[model samples]
Target: METKKNPNLEIGRNSSIYFAIGLNIMLFFTWRGLEYKSYEKDDFAMEILDIGEEIEEDIPITNLEAPPPPPPPPAAAAPDVITIVEDTEEIEETVIESSETDQDDEIADPIEVSDVAVEEVEEEVSVPFSVVENVPIFPGCKGKNNTELRNCFALKMNEHIKKHFKYPESALEMGVHGKVFVLFAVDANGNVSNIKTRGPDKKLEEEAYRIISLLPTMEPGKQRGRPVKVPYSIPIHFKIQN
Candidate 1:
């Protein structure tokens, strides 16, 4: 028996080839549809810039005034003129002798030195009471020797101070009290002078000086048989009894 269809001409033989071509065509169309681009359209208007026209601004002006000039200075005075005068009197010229001498000249004879009188000049001397030959004599103080006179003078001084000592009221109120050392000198004329005092306060010094100033004039102390100043110092106590 023989087959009715030929093998090469069968319909189903190219079905796969046709299906592949159709599948490829569908895939290409699907890919093109997925990759499709769409955008909204916008309209832009055109405008032109004109820089050819120019703008101008106005500025204000200021005027300044100048200062006045200073006045001229005063004129100076003219200097005095001096005139020259010629001398009219004739002057006599004195002849001067030269002192140079030759061997023929004899030297003047030696000046005679016969007798020269010397004058005794007494100087101002100061002597201490202890070393003086004669101590200053206090009032009613008379002694044959220096020792007795010293004792009597010291006794008299103490008595005088006790008799005249008076404390200053100001010093008492101010409570200024101390021992004031009073220094005084019996001059060559036997007068008390140069009284000085040192103490804790001025009130005490004034009182001490006043007390010493009341001392009576005494006989001046003598050194080498001549009167000399004798310096004496005494302590004046300014104490409050209370």
Candidate 2:
């Protein structure tokens, strides 16, 4: 023993250490390079996203909110309603009067009444005179004679007139009895000629003529026996039964 070992030889120990250190450094650098490469890849991805965003902006973009439309123009003012008013004038009519110029002509005239006013004269009225007779001048055929001629004339006339005429109703009803004075001329032949009523009742006068027309010619009125033309007045008396 006691031999002094010779110091082991540490050959390259320092070099190895240095080398390991260098290797670590190199690995670190390689890792760092890889990280840098990843970072570059990420940067390339971001650039592509940016390019998409720009393409989107370049394409037409629609805005949801549009600009407000211009306000509508104010409505036109309505024209005023103007009615024209005209004034009318009324005219009044006047009536004219007519004048008369006839001043001198008078319309009223008066009538004269003096001559009509003269009074009429009054005269005395004379009373009429009459003589009262003592007897009827015509006492019918009293104290008469000359029978043959009287009977013959009376018969002929009575027959003829009774054949022709009739009595009137008024005379029959009134018992119109009165003297009918028939004045008929007796012709020389003894036939009655003119026949008329001399004095008679007012109503019986016509009957008297009718009756006398029935009379025969008188034997001319005789004073003694012979026929003579005498103015004979005959009386007719008409009587009715009571």
Candidate 3:
């Protein structure tokens, strides 16, 4: 069916162009209303004054003289001369007797001196067992040579330890078993000193120390014909037999 078209619906097609033109016209009127204005100019009046010239005065001059120098001191007087007098007298000559002694009239006697013994002072020096020239001699290692004496000393020491070996009762009960290192020194006087021990347990260490301390006195070690303290170290084993 055919229907009549309204003109108001056709004007909507150009409505966007009409809105843009109206917005541009409104922005131009707003910019003109907010235009910047410059401040008004002010007039300044200047006044001139005349300055007078300054006058200078003249200075007076006067002459000055220095005083004369002081006079020098007076010279000292010379000393007077002394006169000497001489007397003529004769002197007599004297005869002197000879004081020489004859060898036949001289007497001589012999002087006798008693004997004096000097005590030797021994210096305490620590010498290692391996490097000592003369090793300490054990109780039963007498009459042995240097090398033989060293071996005998070691053997006797082991024997002594084995003979005196007794496990600590407390250590055995606690099952503490290990090797203990014992260090001792033979002094210049053939006496054992400085006994020390280290082990896993204090009981074992005490036992080792007891055994080492029981060692008999040995002949002191020597170096360069002089006796010296000998330091020796040994390890003792404490093991449980299965």
Candidate 4:
């Protein structure tokens, strides 16, 4: 025997529609809960004024009169007479010379240069290597005249640079290479000083400085037969081979 349930009492006939409606309702409530705001209550008690109540005070009238200020003191009387006496001591007056002059004034005497004291000051002089009367002599350089001496000096300088030239190991590892321009001064005593080096890298500059500083003390360059300081410049190139 089969017993069939009534169509009106079927539980699962509209179950999907019910579940969708319920889910939508739950989502709406959840959104509202997330956005809910609350405020602290301000418990201010308000008082009502009763217009029918009568309030009165029995205050008495008080009369006050301020006293007047005191009078000022009288002024002292001044004497009308002034005395004069003859001053016996003579005061020397300074005479101020007038800067203005007229044609009547005589012209000053011509100054003789010999009468003026002249002081001679000795100052350090620096001359260029090319124009100097005497070129600084490097070690083992000898020549008969200034022209020969300049050539020998240049040759010796190249030889010295070649002898002392070195590559910095750090520079080699870093692949740093450049041409360094070096400017140095030979002092009046023929000592190397003021060595300045500029290059693409500091390593190259330091290497140039080291090589230039190793230069031996030379005979100071002369100008007009007086030994003087000299400035020289040269370029040193650094190249690395792979």
Candidate 5:
């Protein structure tokens, strides 16, 4: 016996069309269930309360009488006459004269004024190395012009540093190597006044200060043809060679 195949059993042939139709039908039913609904508004009536009018009453006034005035004062009596008698005895009075005329005639002694010598105050001003007209002359840097003198001054300073460069033995033993900044001022009198030093170690600072203090007295810098203080700063480096 031979059996015939059902058309619905052949799903592979029309499965896509059937699936699309079923999905569309489900979507339509879902949209209809979720439709928006609007409510109807109810009408309301407003009521107002009535207010009564205010009433006023009139007040009455009474008349009063005033009292009478007081009586006047009495008149004053007359004064009596007096008689005075003259004295016959003579009185001698001594008159005192003013001494202001004698004081005016007398002359005061002249005050002797002694001559006092006033000491002049010298103003000590600091001038920069670059802008100073007459820079502090380093030893052996004489006879050079202003610009040449400045350059020579710097060269001489560097040469002096190298000549006197000494590493502190304590600093070297401790493996301390750093730079020290030394500041010194050449005063108006060509003498080094203030010397300051800063370094990483006390030994290094002391070495720097000693080197600076050894600097010979230089020719004082001049500004406006007058001697002034010149401040100079130099950095010294200390390093240990391998």
Candidate 6:
């Protein structure tokens, strides 16, 4: 005993299996078509690669040439100079003989004959004494007209003092500062002459002389409008204070 099969059930099962197979085939073909389209769009880039490969094959290689060498430096010039040798000659000096001339004979001949006359000459003069009284001393005038004379005299004296002496700092420390009196003559030509120190010290006397020497000649002193030779006197004082 064999039983009969179910035809309707078997047919239904076959229809479901066929539907699943059709869906899988549709999905596989859709993926393959998208991939092929993408490759087709980028085909130009592949042609560029082919062109680069052909260019590389056609290019030829070559050796490069080097640059030219630099020029040489200029030579230095020699210096200009000269050398010389000096030649010297010797000279001899000669001495001459001495003899008496006419001038010497005149001086010596007279003296040799005057021996007796020389014996009679005296050593000193003997003369009678004459008394002098009331000698007139011409003192300078004291007035505005005498100002130039006074200034000139002072200037000379100042110069002389400056030359011969320095300010006495040591003496000043010892309280030994005082005045020295001096007398000098003014001649007709307004020149100072015959200086004298009336009251003296070794230092003071020398200083007085120096000052008098420096003094300029004054306009001669005048008495009643007549110019007269006069004597001028000045006192110089040196003093220091603490």
- Write the residue-wise lDDT of candidate 6 on 54-146 in tens digits: 444566788789888988888887768776867686677887867857654555355556465655642322111111111112234233434
Clashing pairs in 3: none
Candidate 3 per-residue lDDT over residues 150-200, each given as its tens digit: 889989999999999998888888899999999999999899999999999
Instruction: For candidate 1, give the lDDT.
Output: 0.90
Q: Superposing all C-alpha atoms, what RMSD in Å does each candidate have to the true structure?
A: 21.1, 55.3, 15.2, 11.6, 16.0, 30.2
Which window of ten consecutive residues has the lowest lDDT sum in model 3?
38-47
lDDT per residue (tens digit) for residues 189-215 in model 4? 999999999999998999999999999
Best by lDDT: 4
**Per-residue lDDT for 190 in model 3?**
92
> Cα miss at 187, model 5 (Å)?
1.4
* Best model per TM-score: 1
lDDT of model 4, residue 25: 100
Tell me the tens digit of each residue's lDDT in model 1 across 30-71.
Answer: 999999987655544556986876766676787768777878
Listed in order, each prediction's TM-score against the native is 0.54, 0.28, 0.51, 0.52, 0.52, 0.30
TM-score of 3: 0.51
- For all candidates in order, the CA lDDT equals 0.90, 0.54, 0.89, 0.92, 0.85, 0.56
Task: Judge candidate 1 at residue 156 and give its lDDT.
Answer: 96
**Which portions of model 1 show Cα errors greater than 4 Å?**
1-119
lDDT of 4: 0.92
- Expressed as tens digits, the lDDT of each residue in 79-167 for candidate 2 is 79978887687778886765554878576767678646787864422111111111111213332433544454455545555565455
Q: Candidate 4, clashing residue pairs? A: none
Instruction: Give the winner by TM-score: 3 or 5.
Output: 5
Native RMSD of candidate 3 (Å): 15.2
* Candidate 6 structure, TM-score to reference: 0.30
Where model 3 places Cα greater than 4 Å from the true spot, the runs are 1-122, 142-144
Off by over 4 Å in 2: 1-147, 151-165, 189-191, 198-200, 214-230
Local error of candidate 5 at residue 138 (angstroms): 0.6
Better candidate by TM-score, 5 or 6: 5
Quote model 2's TM-score.
0.28
